[model samples]
Target: MAASGKKNNILKVLLIIVLIIGLVAAWLGYQAFMSPSIATSEDYFYVHTDEPYESVIKRIEDEGIVKNPTYFKYVAKSMDLQNGIKPGRYKLSKDLSNRRFIGNLRGGYQEAVPFRFQNLRLKENFAGALGKSFEADSTTFLNILNNETIAEKYGFNKDNFFSMFIPNTYEIYWNTKPEEIIDRFASEYKKFWNADRKAKAAALDMTPEQVSVLASIVKGEALHVDEMPEIAGLYINRLKRGMLLQADPTVIFANNDFTIRRVLNRHLTIDNPYNTYRYKGLPPGPIMMPSIASIDAVLNYNHHDYIYMCAKDDFSGYHNFAKTVAEHQINARKFQQALDARNIKK
Candidate 1:
């Protein structure tokens, strides 16, 4: 009777063990099969690219976009998604398992934002605006552009720093870095400067830097692109004739204050190297970043002996080109009359 009882007890123990194993297996199978796939629009979550990875995971978990961060991290590591997950705004959901979430990220499943550059003045301004749009540090981006080491590595002189960047609308990922933005612009600039453009610049006895400087002047002077070539011609004539460019924009740049309503006689007398009236040649560097149209205009300037130009009194979007001081003075008087009539003293 004792042997039979012991056998029954061993059988019961074995049966309990089998039941426990079966329960565990069933639970694991349920977990594996019940894990959600990529979330659709109904379960979307937004993530800013600037957020750190850990912070992003926390937010995802808190927002119910992910069941657990540990599982996500484990799956991400196993799938080698550490580098594959692009940095940007993403849409995700808690129902999605780690695998699906990573796949969505890798597949660039996010909304795109538009970036436009219309009438930006300084390179810093453009960089700041772009950085804010992308959730990046604008100052950091400007530093990269102004970095001496990087500039030298990229064969950029101080004069050529912002030469290649052309303002236009761009479609970019919200998480793009400032450095990447600059790199893309620089690459685009290089592509625009083809062999024909290089030969044209060289034939005019001008380096790319000098052409860009002239282009900057053109940008500062003319509001209309149609007048750019003629405006460029006027400055080239002044340079060839050993006359001061005498551009008011250079005076404004030298003063470091663009708010002065009028270019006072004293302003011209201010002995800054950038003052074209004082300095016989182009300024040490570009006064501002120039557009591609301006640069192209300078490269293909009108071949005229015009040494001076003054804005038309009618605000006709054209200038009165002159080869003599008297002619320029007359045009200047007409412009002054127009300014006086409109009570605009600048």
Candidate 2:
């Protein structure tokens, strides 16, 4: 009886030990999988193209995104996240668990970054801005824009391809392919030119690209929103009469010198198609990205016989419109006098 009793006690002790061990293991598993791992400092974690999984782990550690790297690594390994890593911008929430973070990465739940640009003067400027906003470099986008084949594929050439990008805020993924971005812009362009807009363009005897070119010119000339329609009307009148646009903004663009406050006779003689004073009608392409307001103004232009506009002498960013050369010369002289008075010699 004594031997049997001792054996029973020994069994009870062993049972207690096993229970303690199981509880400890459960606690450790909870700590690794259920504990909050993410920190609130970073809003996003970026994984670059072809980046090593080990590098991602190190980045998480180095960026202080996770409180415990070991726990994250263990969870990631268990879920096979390394094999399913995707390159993108992932959103990081405060107090996220290791399992949830790893699952998000594995599932490729990326955040869409807002890409916004406007009033850019050149394609190079746009490319540089776009490069800073996304993973694709400036050279990649610029090359695609400059490629004759790609431009032609989109019904444009290198010279006029800049007009295809309608300036606005758009949501896109960080790791979006350069070609995919162009396709998105093309889709947006089609949506913008609906049947009503197309009919208006046809009535004005201009294509969508031509309207954009004029809209850019109008945007460059007009500072006030209300004046845009009048400016558009004036340009349309010039185009209809077969007269040179003789726009000073085009002169500034052709000279590649935006610092010229005043356009002179010397600047007008530039040997470039963009020089509207020397060439006829619109430029080969838009000098700047046209705004939606400017574009709509062109589509709804105010009809008038006034063909000339000179900046008002008051420097209120308003222009004096005239119907004839004699009246336009008077307005120009007043503006010149005002510039001289202000010592704005270019």
Task: Give the best candidate by lDDT.
Answer: 2
Alpha carbon deviation, residue 340, candidate 1 (Å): 2.1
Candidate models: Cα lDDT each: 0.76, 0.91
Structural similarity to truth (TM-score) of each candidate: 0.73, 0.93
How many steric clashes does model 1 contain?
A: 3
Clash total of candidate 2: 0
Runs of candidate 1 with Cα error greater than 4 angstroms are 1-54, 57-86, 91-102, 106-115, 169-177
Candidate 2, pairs of clashing residues: none
TM-score, candidate 1, is 0.73
What is the per-residue lDDT of model 2 for residues 54-102, given as tens digits with 9 covering 90 to 100? 9998988888888878888888899999799889998887778888888
lDDT of 2: 0.91
Name every residue pair that clashes in candidate 1.
Answer: 65-93, 65-94, 66-94
Where model 2 places Cα greater than 4 Å from the true spot, the runs are: 1-23
Q: Which ten residues in a row have the lowest lDDT in candidate 1?
A: 37-46
